[model samples]
Target: MATGSPRPAVLRERVAGLMAGTLTLPLGGCRAALLDPQGPVGAAEKTILLNALAIMLAIVVPTILATLGFAWWFRASNTRARYRPQWVYSGRVELVTWSIPILVILFLGGLTWVGSHDLDPARPLKSTQPAVTVEVVSLDWKWLFIYPDQGVASVNQLVVPAGAPLRLKLTSASVMNTFFVPQLGSMIYTMNGMSGQLYLQADKPGVYAGQSSHFSGDGFSGMQFDVRAVPATDFKTWIDRTKAAGPALDEQAYGALSKQSTDVAPYTYRAVSPGLYEDIVQQHLPPAPGPVAAQPASQVAPVKKAS
Candidate 1:
C-alpha cells in the first residue's frame, strides 16, 4: 500500500502552529507608537483608534466564530446537520446582519466626525502658557525649523518647551511633503508656496521622532528629525546658547541650505533674516530646485492647466 498521509490530528496541530506564527510575525517588528503616545493629542487619537478597533471586533470576532461553527456543523460527517434543500434566508438572520452593520457605520461615522473637529490641526491647544510659534520648511531630504519668536532656526531638529503648546506654520521649499511627529500626533502636509498650521504639545520632557511622512525623492528614507521637549528654563537656555553662536540664516545661507542633500546633521542658526518665512510663502524667495533632474529645453514637458 502507498504511504498514508499524516494523521488528521497531527495535520491540524501543524496547521495551527503555522497560523499562529503567521499572525505573530508582523507584530514582532511593530512599534506601538500610536498606542503608547506621549502627548494629549496622541492620547486622544489612541483612544479613538482603540474604540474603533473594539467596535469592529464586536462583529468581526463573532462572525469569525460563526463561520467556523457553521463549517463544523455542516460538515459531511455530522449526522444531525440540517440539510434543507430549498431553505430561504430567515428574517432573524437578515435583521442581525443588517442591524450590526448599520450600527457599526453609525458608531464609526460619529467617532470620526467628532475626532476630526476636536483634533483640527489649525485649532490652537488650550494652555495657560503662551504657544511657541515654529516655522517649518520641508526641503528635499531635510527639515528646517525656524523659531521666529526666539530669533533662531535649526536644521533637522526641533526644540520646544514641554507642557507648552506649539503653533507650527509649515511650508515646503520643494515638492509637497508631510511633517509628522508620531508621539505628538497630527501629520500635516507642507506644500510649496502655501502655509499650513498645526498645534501640538509635549506632555513631558522627552525626545520624539519626527519625519517627512510623504515620500519626495531618493533621500526620503533618511529624512528624519528629532523633537526635543525640554523644560521651560532649558528651552530658554538653548535659545540663548544657540543665539550666542552659529551663523545667521540670511537669504544667502538659506539658498545654500536649500540644495538637495541627505542625512544632514543638526545645526542651528543664531539669527534668521527678517521676513524670510513670509517671503518663501509669498514666492519672493524662489523655490528650491526639486529632486527632479533638469531636462533638455526641447525635451521638457509643457505644464498643463486643469479646466
Candidate 2:
C-alpha cells in the first residue's frame, strides 16, 4: 500500500482558510454594517468589496504562502533543491503568474466602476419608499441643516430616519466647505454658488460624528455637525418638537447666521422663511452685499407704510 503525503494540501488549506476566516470574522461580519456598508449608500460598494475579498483570498493567501515557502525551501544550501537559474521559465508558470493577478484586478476594477454609477447620489430612490430630502448649507465654520418638508432648521445637528436613504443637497454660504459623516458615507464638497449631492443611511439609530473635511477660515476647526439617525416616527416627532420650540429664521436673520463661528450647540429654528435655503444657495438673497449696498436700517425702509 502506498502512503500519500497530505501535508502540502493540508497546509495550504489550513493557511488559506485561516486567513479568510479570521478576516471575515473580525472585519466582514454582520455587525460590520454599523461602521461601514450596512448603511444605505455604502451598501452597494461594500457588497462588492466583501464579495471580492472573499474571492481574491482564494488565491492571494495561497500565493503568498507559496512565495515564502518557495524562497525558504529552495535555498542554495539545500542539496535537494533544483538549480535552474539559467533555465528558461515554463509557459505554465508564466501563464498562471500573470493571469491570476490580471483576473483579480479586472474584477475589482469592474466592481468599483459599476458601483460608482449605481450609487450616485442623484439617482432616484427606486424603491417605493420615499427618502427624506435634507437641505444642508455649510457655513464658514459651521453647518446648517434645514428640513424643508418639516419646515424646520437646525444648527450643527442633522436628524433623519435610520435605514432610509437620505437625499442631501449641499452648498456653501461663504467659503468652500465639505460635508462628511463617517460610518455612513463619503464626504461631499460644498462650494459657493455651486451645489453637490450626497446620499447616506444609517442601519441603526445613533448619533455619529459629522464634520467639515475641508479647511476654510479661522473657525475651520469648529466646522462640524451631528448626524442623528433614528426611527422614522421618532424623527418626525423630533422635527415637530424642534419646530414648536424654536423661532423663525428669516432672510435678515439668516444673513446674520451665516457668519463664521465654531463650537456650536444644536438649536432649531421653528419657522424658516420660504426659500431660505435657496436664498443662501444664491448668495445674493442676503440683506445687503458690499459696503456700497449696505445702508443704515433707518435709511432702508420706514417702519410705517410708505403710502
Per-residue alpha-carbon lDDT of candidate 1 for residues 60-179, written as tens digits (9 for 90 to 100): 999999999999999999999979999988999899999999999999999999999999999999999999999999997899999988899999999999999999999998999999
Off by over 4 Å in 2: 1-38, 55-60, 286-307
User: Judged by lDDT, which candidate is best?
Assistant: 1
Clashing pairs in 1: none
Off by over 4 Å in 1: 1-31, 294-307
Q: Write the per-residue lDDT of candidate 2 for residues 110-178, one digit (tens) a residue.
A: 887897788776776554558788899877567888888888889999888887878899988776778
Question: What's the true lDDT of residue 11 in model 2?
Answer: 82
**Model 1 TM:** 0.86
